[model samples]
Target: MKPVDSPERTKNRTRSGRRGGESTTRTDILTAARHLFGENGFTKTSMRSIATEAGVDVALVSYHFGSKRGLFTAVMEVPGDPISRVTAAASGPRSDLGRRLITTFTSIWENDDMGVALQAMLRSAVNDDGAAKAFGDFASGEMMPALAKTAGLSQETVRAIGSCVFGLALMRYLIRAESFTSLTVDELVDQFGPKIQAIVDQGR
Candidate 1:
């Protein structure tokens, strides 16, 4: 029999070749889901397809993630409580808000596991409005309110700030689509952090 070199099959084989154990099962599922979501976009990628790619039963995937949306959330896993971090930085006496904000974002996106997770999540957001809405909902419910509290901005201003940060997150870490990707997190902090902080400082 001839081997099939189709993208799905090839990707499935690549995913399956990794060591087996239930401990790694969730990670494996996430890895496969990320690849699919990144390449095919969220709407096109299905839970069953993810299971097939991972060489696991559909039930297993369903068991772990519960639904396609849930799987996407798992696949796009951003490290740490993004809400808490942003709010904490925003709340601190209005001094060096940019530095704190930059440092916090840097810490989350620079780490290997979190970086991949966050990148995967952003890719979904780029390709799926539902995913984008989910991200917005998170910011609106958790991150924005806290930011508003600390920055003394109205909800509209907070939303705008969230939009800017979301754009930065997508462009820099998720797509890595430009010269910006080459810059170290510290360099990014120095360059972009102050600008972000300025926005919060003005609090318009």
Candidate 2:
């Protein structure tokens, strides 16, 4: 007859094996957290849910990311050459600049993976001030400056141009304004890019 296993011994074996087999590290935690937060907005996702999704303990999630907000901030930050892509697309042929700009932005927004990251950030921005600041920093630090430089516009003029673009993005994307939705990309360019171009052309 085999010796009876002690309850405490079995518990220890299970716990040790659990960590040994499936311990989640920082990168794993971040990946899991981003997925949950992306699918279910910031407020809806929880540490426990992230751990469950990651197949780790909730404590591990806290240990790695510090808190939900930290994880969220991390999730919002996507690494890319934002300036390079936009400037490259916007650089040549001033006559086609407007079309190029609109098309490039639309293409970025439509890309599935990038779209999830952007939507996650946008959702966070809708509810959190810190997220909004991060979004602004990313745009102002990289995207706006690069775009303005590409267009050869001054700081003040860039601000005006950014405002118009922001207004268009908000109405068309976030708000889904009926008037703006259902319009083709070319139609949007024809209607709005000229207005943006006028500001860029003035540069005051």
Candidate 3:
């Protein structure tokens, strides 16, 4: 698959200048993008589709947003402090760490706008090498460390626990993977909690 440009790379590349009905046009595009992104996700939703939805020329999307990723960033930005939430999840009794963390992670996606942000981020990472490396760095250097610090475990251990859990968010929400999506949150906790606790217990 061809890589899409990261939002930062194309941030300054937008075509500028006011056109007739520019405000309305931009609003239209944003409205269309929001709908398509919510319904089809970042990867499946195309600039042309957004344009079609907005009844605008495809070039207008590039003119205003720079690229598909740029549009996603502008419109589908994720909200809340995930790192803080992770820290909170890791607090208290460490015995139920797996269940606590899994519940918090799933709540972020299922209950709010964070799901859209994560979906876009995941799709972008899959489609763009730069996005993958950029997010990977944050996951390794930042987010995982918070969980490690709070849980009294090494980053490697937290990552191992995360590796066992985070994928289910993608499978259930993003990929809509069979069987995986069919399971309830409690079912996921029942299945993944033990594996995550196993890693945590190893303390490696």
Candidate 4:
């Protein structure tokens, strides 16, 4: 007869194998998600693939992230290029900062990956309060600080500009409002630039 492994040894083997500790398993899922999403994009990547890459059960992925949208939102917490892009826009002539910022934002949203990311974020935020807070924190922590430091802007001005950006993003990108869609990017910059400038002036 085959020798039976002790119960303690069997338990140790289970923990040491692909099924890691709880926190370790959570981190593995996120790591797997980032790699797959970056390589395959959101639509092509699935929960099963992510779990497979992480060497965990699909149910564990669900237990941690709740859903694919939730996982995407969680993945977004890993830093992205938006902060760098914002820094570039802000680190420019103070006079036309508004136009630069608007231009930068519009261009970003136009990218396919970013557009999908926005959809995931908006959809996930609908029911999950933590998802909404993550976005708010990213805006306040990364985007706001970059603008405030590079452009000599106050928190209030940055907040107002952020509001305008988010509002336009929601209406133009997410909601697909015809009124917003009717305008070209140049037209958007033309119309919104001065408004942002006025806010920037106030914060000075």
Candidate 5:
């Protein structure tokens, strides 16, 4: 007869599997949320739909994210926290602020899988008042203040800089304008860096 497995070994194996599966389950929910939100926009996509897409019970979605708004916030938060990244980049030497900001922003879009979710949020903001308000509030309340504090600029100036950078990214990546898309990241940065720097200089 085969030897019986030890109770302690079985217990440890069960705990490990449970921990691993919980992480996997959370990841699945997030992946499903991103895809659905990207395709359907915020108003059209429901928590139940996300649950269905993730193949988890609807209650689990609530357990993980609290609500749809909470989930949307989590989705919009790119890995490494885009706001913190920008603040850190701006915290460097004042002379290099433009180059740093542009370089960091471009690198983020190029390296991360956030483009789709960003596009979705932009689209939703355009069409939905609620989404527009939420997006604007987040930018004004959270991002602009942090960036302005670090960069030593007025919130208005930082907001304008953010708009310019966002427009560039939208044209280059989301809209895929041929001319913008054709340029390398360095080339685009070189071209835009002066304009951004000019704005940063004004804040001094």
Candidate 6:
């Protein structure tokens, strides 16, 4: 006959199993959310569908992310906060701020995985009002104000500067325009940095 297991051993085993399962569950949900969000855009992808794709209970998605918007936020978070990175690039010598911003922005797009994720966010923003609003609010409310404070520029002026940078990124990454896409990051920076600088310098 086999000896009975101790209560403490059984409890430890159960706790370990739960911890492992929780981590796997969260990862699976995020993976499913990213795939669905990319394929169907934010408006169309439902929590139930993501759960189905992840082979998880729908409640798990709710438990993990709270809601679809929360899940999207999680998906979009990069290693270094993109907004903070941009703000940092915009800070310091006003003379070189434009070049710094362009270089930093382009480097982010050149990051293979991050570029794909950002592209998805942009695509969803185009066709979904909610997504568009969220993106706009982030730019206008968070990034614009931070950049304006850093560059010592008026909010409106900073907004225009942001528009130019985002437009360049949109054309190059999302539209995949032949002319824009063909240029190397350095070349694009060389070509557009001055234009951005012009906008930025006006405020100084």
Please give, for residues 140-178, the per-residue lDDT of candidate 2 as tens digits. 666777877786657797788668766776777778899
Number of the candidate with higher TM-score, 2 or 6: 6
State model 6's lDDT: 0.79
- Model 1 misplaced stretches (Cα beyond 4 Å): 1-76
lDDT of 3 by residue, 158-194 (tens): 7777776667766787789988988887887788877
lDDT of 1 by residue, 178-201 (tens): 887888877888887778777766
- Candidate 3 local Cα displacement, residue 166, angstroms: 2.6
The regions of model 2 sitting more than 4 angstroms off are 1-24, 28-74, 77-80
Steric clash pairs (candidate 4): none
List the lowest-lDDT window of 10 residues for candidate 3.
11-20
Q: How far is candidate 2 from the true structure (C-alpha RMSD, Å)?
A: 8.1
Clashing pairs in 2: none
Give candidates' CA RMSD values in order.
Answer: 9.7, 8.1, 13.8, 10.1, 8.7, 7.9
- Provide the overall lDDT of each model, using Cα atoms, as 2-decimal numbers: 0.73, 0.70, 0.75, 0.80, 0.78, 0.79
Give me candidate 3's TM-score against the actual structure. Answer: 0.61
Q: The CA-based lDDT of model 1 is what?
A: 0.73
> Of 2 and 5, which scores higher on TM-score?
5
Q: Write the per-residue lDDT of candidate 5 for residues 106-141, one digit (tens) a residue.
A: 877777566666667677767876566656666666
Considering lDDT, where higher is better, how would the candidates rank from best to worst? 4, 6, 5, 3, 1, 2
Clashing pairs in 1: none
The local lDDT score (0 to 100) that residue 50 gets in candidate 1 is 91
What ranges in model 3 sit over 4 Å off? 1-76
